[model samples]
Target chain A: MDTQGTFRQTVEPALVRRLQRGELAAFETIYRRFERAAWTLALRLTGRADVAQEVLQDAMLKAFERARQFRGDAPFAAWLRKLVVNEALMQLRHDRLHVIELFDETHADDDAPAPWAHADSATLDRALNRLPDAARAVLWLYHVEGYTHLEIAEQFGRSTSFSKSQLARATKRLRELLAPQAEDTPCTIGSTTTA
Target chain B: MHDRLDHHRMTGDASLAAALRALPASTPARDAWPELASRIRRRRVVRKAVWFTLPAAFAAGMALTLAWPHLQRSTASPAPVRVAMQSSSHATPPAAPDIDALQASSQQWQAWVQTLDRDGAPLDGRQLTQAVALQDRIGLVDLQLSAARNPSTTVGLWQQRITLLQQLGLLHLQPYLVATQRPASHDHLISM
Candidate 1:
C-alpha cells in the first residue's frame, strides 16, 4: 500500500490509452501496480478468500473489456475500485447474503469514545466479518472507501436512509464487538472504557 | 478521486475509519496471474477471430449479391456484349500488379504507420532511425512520381514507396508483436 502512492504518480493518461487499445503489457503493468489494493478491497468486502480472488479476476477482466468506456474523467484506480465494489456487491446479491436487518445492540455505547481506535487489524478484521453483509459493506464503502451516502445508495440500489441506517448499525455493532470484557483475552486489544 | 464524505461528521466513526485506513494491503496466497493470463489469451483469440471473420463474411456476401444479377443475365442470354466483356477482361491478363490497388494499399499502410506512431508505438533508437529513413524514402518516391515519368517508372516508384512503408510499419509493429508472444518470465516487471 505504501508503494502504491509512488506508482500512482506515474500512471499517465497515455497508459490509459494503451489499455484502451487492448495492450496487454499496459494492463499487466496496471495489474501489478494495483493488485494489492484490489485484492485487499475484495477480501474486506466479501469476507471470503475464494470469493475475493474470483472478484478480483472478474473485475480485472471487466476493466479490460470496458476500457473504451473509460472517459478519463476519474483516475484509473478509482474506476478499477468501482469495478471491484460492483462485482463484490453483485456476488453478495447472488448469494443473498447482503440483508440489512437493524442490529439490536442496545448495550453498545452511543456517546463513549471509540474503543476500536487501538484495536489491531486482525481484531477489527474478525469483528468486521461478523457483521451482516449489507451493514459491513455499507460501513466499509462509507468510511474506508470514502463513498458518499448517495453513491453507496446507488451502488446498493437502496435509499440514502438505508445507507445511513446500515452504517449506524454497523458502527454500533463494531463498538459492542470491541467493548470491554472481564479479562483481556490473548487477542483483546486496548479498551477505552473505565472500570 | 472520490469526494470523501466527512466521516468525522458522522457520529464518532473517525477512529474506526482511521483504523480501516491504516490496514495494510493484502495479497493472494498464490499469484493469481497465470490463470488471468490464460483467460486473457482465450478472450483475445476469440476477439481476433470475430474481427477477422466479420469483415470477410461481409465482403463475401456483398460480392455474391453484386454478382448474382450479372450471373443470371449471362446465363439467360450469351449476347455479343457478353463476349466483348469477356474478351476485354481476358486482355488484362496477370503480368503486372494493378497500380491503383498498389497505391491504395500504400496509402493505407502509411496511415497505419502514422497512427501507430501517434499512439507512441515503442521503437528503440535504431528502429526509430530506420523508420525516419524509410519515411524520407517514401517522400522521395512521391516527389519522383510527380515528375515526367514513363508508366513503368511510375509503377516502380509506387512499389518502392509501398515497400518502404511496409518496412516502417513492421518496425513500428515489432514491440506489440513481442508483447503478444507473452514473455517466459515477468522478472522484467520489476524494472518496468
Candidate 2:
C-alpha cells in the first residue's frame, strides 16, 4: 500500500543513476545530503532519539542495498524517505510506542481546533512533543508531510476515520496546550534556519 | 478587532500546517555512518554467501532427485520398520515413574496457575499464545493418558502431563513473581 510514495520527493536523476550502479560514494553522498531531513522525519514520527537513529541507519542500509530496484519515475529522495518512514513505523510497531503513551488520556480532545498559528515555535514544539505519539504522527503525516488520509490509515493499519479522528484530537490537544500562553507570544509560520 | 480575528481564523489551518513544516530539523547527537557502513558490509557478505551456497544447494537437490528412485529400488523394503511402528502404540517403557507424584504435582501446578489467572493480571500476546499452546499439549497428553492400556504407558503419559503443567504454571507464575520480586523456584518437583 505504501509502495506509491512514502519517500521525500526530491529528484536528482544523475545521483539516482549512479546509485543504481551500487556505487558506495554515491550512497554516502545521498546519505550526507538527506541525513538531517530523514533523521528529523524519523525523530518526529517516533519521538525517541535512539529509535530515530536506528531508523536512519537501517533506512540508509536498505536504500543502498536495494538501490538497483529504483524505478526512476519518482525522485530518489522520495524512495529513500519511504524507507526511513517504514523503518520508523516498524520501530513503533515493535515497541508499541503509542500504547505506552496512550495510558494517560487526560490530554485527549476530539472536538478541539488547531490554533497553532499564533503559538511561537518553542511553545508549539514543546506542545507537539507532549502530544501522544500516535496523535502527533497523525498530525505531522496529514498536515506537513503531505500524506493522504488513506495512506496514513494504511500505514497505521486503521480506518481513514481513525486518521481523521486522531488529527482532530491532536489539534484539540494542541489548542489546550497553548491556551494558557496564547495571548503572550506572536509566532512566525515562516521557514526555519538550518540547525 | 473582529475583522482581524476572522481573517486569522479563516487561514488558521493553512498557517498551522506551514508552522509545522517550519519546525526545526535536527541532527542526531551521534553519527550513524559507521554502524550503517558495517550493516551494508554485513548484508553484502550475507548476499555473497547465499549466492555461493544457492547453486550448490540446487545441484544437491538435483542430484538427489536423480538418485532417489534408484536408491529406493536398491534398498530392501522396510517391513520391520513398518511392523515396529504398528506395534509401538501398545509397547510401554519398563520402569514407569510414580504416577501419584506426577498427578499430585500436576494438580498443584494447575491450581497455582488457575489462582494466578483468576487474579486478573494482564498477559501480553506472546505469553498468552504460549499458555494456549501449553494447554493444548496438556490436552493431547490427557487424551493419550485416557487411551493407555499399560501402567507403564499411563505413568509415562502422567509424567508428560506434569512437565507440561509445570511449563504452563511457569508461564503465568514468572510474570507474577517478577512483578512482585519474589524468589523463583528453579528446581523441578522435589520428590520425583
CAPRI grade of model 1: incorrect
Report the lDDT of model 1 for residue A90: 75
lDDT of 1 at B145: 87
Considering only chain B, report the TM-score of model 2: 0.42
Model 2 segments beyond 4 Å from truth?
A: A1-11, A97-115, A181-194, B1-10, B75-192
- Candidate 1, residues A1-195, lDDT tens digits: the string is 346622133467998899999898998988878877788888788888888898889888878878888887777777787888888887776675545576774644555667667566667777787788888888999988888999888777779988888888888888777665212543554322101
Q: In model 1 chain B, where is the ten-residue run with the lowest total lDDT? A: B183-192
Q: How many backbone clashes does candidate 1 have?
A: 0
DockQ of 2: 0.22
Instruction: Indicate which candidate wins on DockQ.
Output: 2
Candidate 2 residue lDDT tens string, B73-155:
43324556744654786563323324554465557656656755664345779989998998899999999988987555666
